[model samples]
Target: MGSLAFFIASLGFLLPLVSNANPLDKRAAALKPFNLRVTFKPAAYAVPSTIQHVQDAVACGASNGVTVTAKSGGHSYGSHGLGGEDGHLIIDMRNFSNVTVDQTAQTANIGPGGRLGNVATALYNQGKQAISHGTCPGVGVGGLTLHGGYGLSSRGRGLTLDNVLEATVVLANSTVVTASTTQNPDLFWALRGAGAAFGVVTNFKFKTFTAPENNIVFQYFFSPSSASQLATALTALQDFTRNSQPPELNMRLFLSSFTTFSGVYYGSRSDFDKIMNPLLSKMGIGSGTVSTNSWLNTLTSFSNGPLAQTGTYDTHETFFSKSLMPEYMSPEAITALSNYWNANARSNSRQWYLLFDCHGGNGSAITKVSADSTSYAHRNATFKMQFYDRVASGNYDPSWMPFLNGWVKSITDAMPSVNFGMYINYADTSLTKDEAHTHYWKDNYKKLVDVKMQYDPKRVFEGPQIVGS
Candidate 1:
């Protein structure tokens, strides 16, 4: 305790330190997360504005025998950013929210705290450049790129992680190092896919690409009465995606009030029509809307409002989400999922939606990236499906976990032959560590474990489901 206090006093810069001993109000504010499903109180929360402060925070944790977790956006579904369990030291990186672009170099150096919306706006406004990323404006760049940054643009352009060129990281041993393909290559590989378990990356250097000139958004809705009807529609879409999906087109199927299919095209309207018209006809659907807009406008249309999260409360949700990256969705499994949805979707009082985002097809950039280059598994996935459910009001009930889990199980059970791996970003906290090993990273789990042994052998960056921990 004396050492911790002395260390805090010795710091030259202004650092916001919130300890568990602090009043509930202050501690609550510090520990607040984007997902309200799980709650864990950290022993200390340090908001570091500079790299020195980050290093000092890591040093303090190492000296005190306290596990350290870095929180960028605090958007982890399982609250892993808050140490997943509790009694750890949290290094919050919200102050590191700057995005700088090197126009001549054709790259962008992004802070760990930069949000998707803000990053997009800055990248485009400054350089007319962009990186493929998720649509959520509030998702932190650190978590998104570290895991898998899947979005409408990801199919055409690669994932946000794919664009990563380098990073400045604070290791668990309290040493700072630069990681990239040339320097600390092993750390760089682990950082790209399973970063949270390895170190706290203060900044990222990403190779940028020219923003598309013609950004077209399309939407198609269908009203299927029976499970078979839903199955037919999904099967048609899946068959089409497996064989003919274009790199310029990114799309998803959403099960909501209306069964809808929507996405963005990076090309002209005529080109989009030529490709989509055939799919629509095959699905036995005729009418859908297509609108072309500027890149910024298209991004804003996907967001709820402004891309940056700016408010007293950092915008949260009471929900649970699970994801699956499947090489193929068998017709039997599709029918089973449709049956489950038809039987229970409307009966439940909670707000929910199932989304199937296309990740693999004829010439997907996502699959083009070699799976062995980075620790990110499921590179050959045909589609990434996310099942999300949130409470209508108030906090989520713990008992509802099984209900959501069951929804995912229905599909996986039906397709016993397939290995539907889970996405680490949309983490399911319910799984045991052993189950997580197989579901999150299939063939790469062993390699991740070896990397963890090398960089953080003692597991300073510990969490419930963190790789190797």
Candidate 2:
């Protein structure tokens, strides 16, 4: 029998008692993801509060031969946490929020449902500890860690997945297992980069670093008269990051209201100035606003609201985003991208922006690890670029896709030397399954497929872009 037909046929046997199953009529109306572009209705919903409750939900899905997925912060750009498409059992994991620290060992046991903001606060308050994670406060630990977590601290400390030591997972068979370097080594390797495809991770143990002190936040804005000037500014920044950029210095180029460069340096003002003087001189820009602050305050400054996703996941956006992990862009590519943005952005009413996050350099911790050590394959990426566009506040227009796609093409068409890869966290729904595999996993795709076959032979943990789906 076919997969869908067999799943339906096998439901006649035993109906396990999974708690808090919303009625079919009500399930469709509730539960919205961060992105409103895709509307989904799961076949059922299970709001589990404990590990046993999670296990029972998995058991129920196994008995009924239904696919299952877990929702932590529900911040997926494609809404994949809500089964990506629909008709699968959804496990709401928001109730498992907890961040417990072991100060003696400098390790933290974080619940999968914990958001990045809350995790940051708890770690700082308890032991003045922290882990490399994203800037967005509402992003969940599960999705960020499973994919690849990049933040201002990533270049200094490494990606969040690099800090993960172990995980407690409930498998497709409803059996609990501990995955680590010493136990279930294969599962551990896969979970670091592709955790969502193998099982429902209940908890994560991460090795923490002592929070950096005296963070210096800086911002510079430029209004270039021509596209070539903008390209010159970008090229200067790229050359600065080419090699031996200090680990303590992090910078991001923003293509927004004005061509802007902003970031946090995890060091003193004198040291930050020393490191930045040459770059500032190259671009002929005066010293921008630079100030010193504590580590916790620095985190607060980067977020929109309080660093907690407690009561409800209210932050929502109707937007489309695409990412690229490319080597340094040539002057021709930057000029082409600048000209396109200058020509079209003023005529369009849609809100759009782009961010280029510095990643690879001799001093960066992200590239220090071996490429084969984990499933994440983009160790050589010089930087990751995120392109986002959205309607003001309503349902997204299908016709707007071409504008964003064209913006990306302006860069790729002008440059042929840069081998670009896409970041899975900023997933684009337009790509086919094969394209997704090639851009996201690259050489690691085959290993991820093998792990999926071993752990989830029936494709129980499924989504539209899920491995082996």
Q: Quote each prediction's TM-score.
A: 0.95, 0.92
Q: Any runs in candidate 1 off by more than 4 Å, and if so which?
A: 1-6, 9-27, 311-313
Give a tens-digit lDDT track for model 2, residues 149-199.
Answer: 899898888899999999999999889999999988888889887778999
Question: What's the C-alpha lDDT at position 350 in model 2?
Answer: 77
Find the number of clashing residue pairs for candidate 2. Answer: 0
Worst 10 residues of 2 by lDDT: 12-21
Residue 116 CA displacement from its true place in model 2, Å: 1.1
Please, what's the RMSD in Å of model 2?
3.9
For each candidate, the alpha-carbon lDDT, in order, equals 0.84, 0.81
Quote the lDDT for 282 in model 1: 73
Give the per-residue lDDT of model 1 (tens digit) for 285-316: 66778888788888887787887566433578
Which residue pairs of candidate 1 clash?
none
Lowest lDDT sum, 10 consecutive residues, model 1, at 12-21
**Best by lDDT, which number?**
1
lDDT of 1: 0.84
